[model samples]
Target: MKITFLGTGTGIPQDGRVQSGVLLDTGKNLLLFDCGCGVLGRIHESGYEHKDIDAIIITHLHLDHVGDILALIKANWLLGKTDMRIYGPQGTKEWFEKTLDVYDYLRDRFTVEITELSPEEEFIPQGTEGNCNCNIRSAKTAHTDNSLAYRIESSHKTVVYTGDTEPCQEVMELAEDADVLIHECSFPLGFPMTNHTTPDLLTLMMDEYPLTAKKLYLTHLYPQMQGRYREATDHIRKYYKGEVIIAKDLMVVEIQDD
Candidate 1:
């Protein structure tokens, strides 16, 4: 599986970064996670055809995460590819409906299948041709009321993507023993925050609960993390022995052997 960080920034704007979005190329199909603002352009910039996305899995409904979802769906429709299956936490169906309700021209232009998922539930997306190439699971996260952390496993490797979360045991357990944990380190060290992560808060989770992944890639950065990349990694390394990387836009990771 190839994971691409299409947009690594948060709601705040910054140079060389957009909002939250990532792509997992399963080789069979492309699984898109969190299509936030600027993700559509980033998808094009990343050399990925927007129409090739088979499914979109959302972690939450925050604007920073779901901002570009409508634009993407409309883009696919323009490309004559309208069939899409989207899976997400509880308010997903309602959110999509409400979002589309405001756009009179876009509604009924495509066939969208939205599935509402719950913690601990696992399933393959409906449109996979044969046996699903990967197993996808979700766990409750400490962000919004319906936020989720996802665990995706191909035959060879497992990866966890934490959308936007604070240091929480449920997300930690969801990431246990995965090859890479793509977590949100939204702030820099010593930045007092809530419902988001900082290097200090993440390491606190590391020291207490322990992230067992071989590598940890931090994304969903706020402007606060602008020049603190090295310092953040240094702080995390004090508790986590694995490689700690600050993810950038368009950075790619192959899960099978990374």
Candidate 2:
């Protein structure tokens, strides 16, 4: 499995970082997680064709996470690739309908299959049916009422993406034994924040449940995280024994089966 960090920034803009987006290529299918602002361009910058994305799995309806959903669909529509599969938490279908209501011109231009998923629900994304090499499971996150974290297992490798959340048990359990945990670290080590992650808060949770993921890639950075990457990794290393990495935009990581 190959993972690409398309956009690693947050709602706040920063140099060299866009918003929240990650692309996972399972060799059989390409899945996009969290298509936030600037992700469309980042896709091209990363040498990927936006229209080739098989499915988009969203975490929440926050603007920073869903900002580019319509844009991507529209871009594909313009390129004559109209079919899109979008899966997300409750209110996903309603949110798309409401958003499309304003842009009526683009409403009927293409076909979009939107599935509203619940916590703990597992399913294979559309268009990857026959192979069925990839399976995705969702878990409720601590950030919003319907926000979700996803666990994707394929080719004997597992990757967990914590969209946007504080230190929580539901996500930790979902990510247990994953090969890669792409978690959000929105703030610095000692920054006081809620509904987002800090190095201190993450380590506090790790001290209790103990994340056994082989690799931990910190993402969803805010400007405050600038120059604090080493400190955050060092702090988490003291509590966790896995390889800690700070994800950067367009960076790629590949996991192979043993």
Candidate 3:
């Protein structure tokens, strides 16, 4: 499996970052997570066609996460690919329906199937011929009332992608023993915040509930994290003895034997 960090920033824009989005490739299918504001453009910039995405799993309904979903679907239609399966928390179906209702031209331009998922639900997306068997599971995240974190396991390695969450036990438990945990560290140390994480808050929680993943990559950064990436990783390093990296756009990780 290959996980690509398409956009690592949050709602607030930064110079090098766009918004919250990631892509996972199992050499069989492409699974996109959280198509935020600039994600469609980033997909094009990353040299991948928009129609290549097999499915999209959204973590929440936050604008930074779901902003460009329409654009993605539209682009796929332009490329003669009209099928899309979207998995998201409750209200997802309604959200898409309502969004489409507003755009008269888009309502009939393409067809998209939206599935509402609950925490702990797991399913395998339909794949084309000669693709590896892959499965995805979701766990409730504490960022919002309906936020979810996802774990995708294909071939052998597992990769956990936390949408936008505070340091919560449910997400940590869901991520246990995974090869890579891609979590959101939105703020720097000593920043008082809620519904999001800081380096101090994460380590403080890690003191009680340790993360067992082989590596941790932090994404969904805010402008506040600017110039503090190394410090954030160093702080978490003291508590979690694993690879900790601050994810950048276009960074790719291959989940194969190292």
Candidate 4:
């Protein structure tokens, strides 16, 4: 499995980061998570064609998470790719319909299959026309009432992606024994916040979870992490024995089966 950080910024953009988006390739299928604004451009920049995406998994309905979904579908339509599948938490179907209502031209341009996933739902994602197979399971995270984090496994490798959440037990359980954990660290250490994660809060959870992943990459960075990126990693390093990296746009990590 291979994972690429397409966009790692927050609702607000920063210098090197764009918005929220990650591309995962489980050697056979290409899956996308969170197509926020700027992701289409970043997908091109990351050497991926927009038409190659097999499915899109949304963690929440926030603008920073689902902002560019319609744009992605439109771009794919322009490229002659019609089949697009979307898996998201409850209300996803409603959100898609409401979002496409404003764009009449887009309503008939592409065929989208939107599946509303319940908490703890698990399934194998067979690419369009059954081209590839990747098993995916999701657990509800602490971001919102319907937010979720995903665990993707294929070819004997596993990776967990926590969309946008405070350190939560469900996320910890989903990450257990995963090769890589792509979690969110929205702020620096000691910053008091809710519905988002800080290095301190993550570390507190780490003491209890003892992450099983070999590496932890933190994404969804806010502007508050501007000058304090290294500090955040350093603080969490004490609790987590694995590598902790602050993710940047276009960063790619290749997952190999040992």
Candidate 5:
């Protein structure tokens, strides 16, 4: 499985970083997670076509996490590729309907299957036009009531993506012994915030939870974390014995099977 960080920034604007988006190419299919504002262009910049996205897995309903859903679908429509399956937390169906209501011209132009997922729901995503035998499971996150963190497994390679959450037991359980954990670190250490993460808050879990991923890539960065990358990684390194990475736009991670 190959992972590409499409956009790593948050709602706040920052240089070299856009809102949340990630692409997981599991050899046979391309699975997209979170299609924020600038992700459409990043998809092209990363050398992948928007029309090839088989399924979209969204983590939450926040604008920063779902701003480009319509745009992406429209882009695919223009390319004559209209079939897509989108999965998200509860209320996703309503959200898509409400958003499409404003644009009547494109309302019935394509085939979009939206599935609302609850915590612990398991499903198999058969890539839009290919056969990808991958299992996906989600857990409720701590950010929003319907927010979810996904664990994707294919060929013994597992990757956990924590959309945007504070330290939570559900996410820890979902990421146990995974190859990589693409978590969110929205702020720097010592930054007072709720419903988000900082280095201090994440490290607090290491003492007890003990992050089991071999690699931890922190995404969903805010502008406030511009100058604190080293400090944040240093803090996590103090307790965890794994690679800590600050995800950037267009960054790629190839997941190899054991």
Candidate 6:
């Protein structure tokens, strides 16, 4: 499986970072997670056709996470591709309807299948041929009432993505034994924040849950994280024995079967 960090920034703008987005190529299918602002252009820059995305899985309805969802659908329609499958936490269908209501011209131009998922629900995203060769499980997150974290298993590899949350047990349990945990580290080591993560807060949770993921990639960075990457990674390394990385926009990581 291949994972691409399309946009690593948060609602707050920063240089070189856009917003929350990740593209996962499971060899049999291409799945997009969190199509935030600027992700559409990032997809074009990543050398992948946006129309080829098999499904879009969202973690929440926050503007920073769902900003470019409509833009992507519109872009695909312009390119003569219309069918889209979108899966997300509760209210996904309603949110899409409300958003589309604003664009009178774009309404009825294409077809979108929206599925609202619940915590602990497992489902398969269908590819062009049929169901993709992977399974996805969702867990409720601490960021919002319906925010979720996803565990994707394919080709004997497991990857977990935490959309936006503070240190929480539900996500930690869902990420157990994952090959890579793409978590949100929104603030610096000691920054005081709520509803978002700091290095200190994450390590505190790790001390209790004992993260078993083989590798950890931090994303959803805020501007405060600038120049503190090494510090944050070092802090987490002291508590966990896995490889720690600060994800950057357009960076790619691949996991292969043993």
- TM per candidate comes to 0.97, 0.98, 0.97, 0.98, 0.98, 0.99
Indicate whether candidate 3 or candidate 5 has the larger TM-score.
Answer: 5
lDDT of 5 at 216: 97
| Tens-digit per-residue lDDT, 1-258, candidate 6 | 999999999999899999999999998799999999999999999999999999999999999999999999999999999889999999999999999889989988999988899999999987767899999999999999999999999989999999999989999999999999999999998788988999999999988999999999999999988999999999999999999999999999989777
Q: What is the RMSD, in Å, between candidate 6 and the native fold over all Cα? A: 0.7
Following a full C-alpha superposition, what root-mean-square deviation does model 1 have from the true structure?
A: 1.3
- Maximum-TM-score candidate: 6
Better of 1 and 3 by lDDT: 1
- Candidate 3 worst ten-residue window by lDDT: 124-133
What is the Å distance of residue 243 in model 1 from its true position? 0.5
TM-score of 4: 0.98
Can you tell me which runs of candidate 2 are displaced by over 4 Å? 128-132
Residue lDDT tens for model 2, 148-215: 99999998899999999998999999999999999999999879899999999999998888999999
- Cα lDDT tens digits, model 3, 1-258, are 888899999888789898999999888788889999999998888877778888889999999999999989888888788778888999899889888888878877777878899999998875434333788899999888988999988888899999999999988888899999999999999999998999998998888889999999999998889989999998899999989999999998887776
- Evaluated with lDDT, which candidate comes out highest? 6
After the best TM-score superposition of candidate 2, give how far the Cα of residue 224 lies from its true spot, in angstroms: 0.7
lDDT of 4 by residue, 94-114 (tens): 999998888977777878988
Q: Candidate 6: where is the Cα deviation over 4 Å?
A: none
What's the ranking of the predictions by lDDT, best on top?
Answer: 6, 2, 5, 1, 4, 3
List the global CA lDDT of all models.
0.90, 0.93, 0.89, 0.89, 0.92, 0.94
After superposing candidate 5, which stretches have Cα over 4 Å from the reference?
none
Tell how far residue 37 is off in model 1, in angstroms: 0.7
Better candidate number, 2 or 6, judged by TM-score: 6
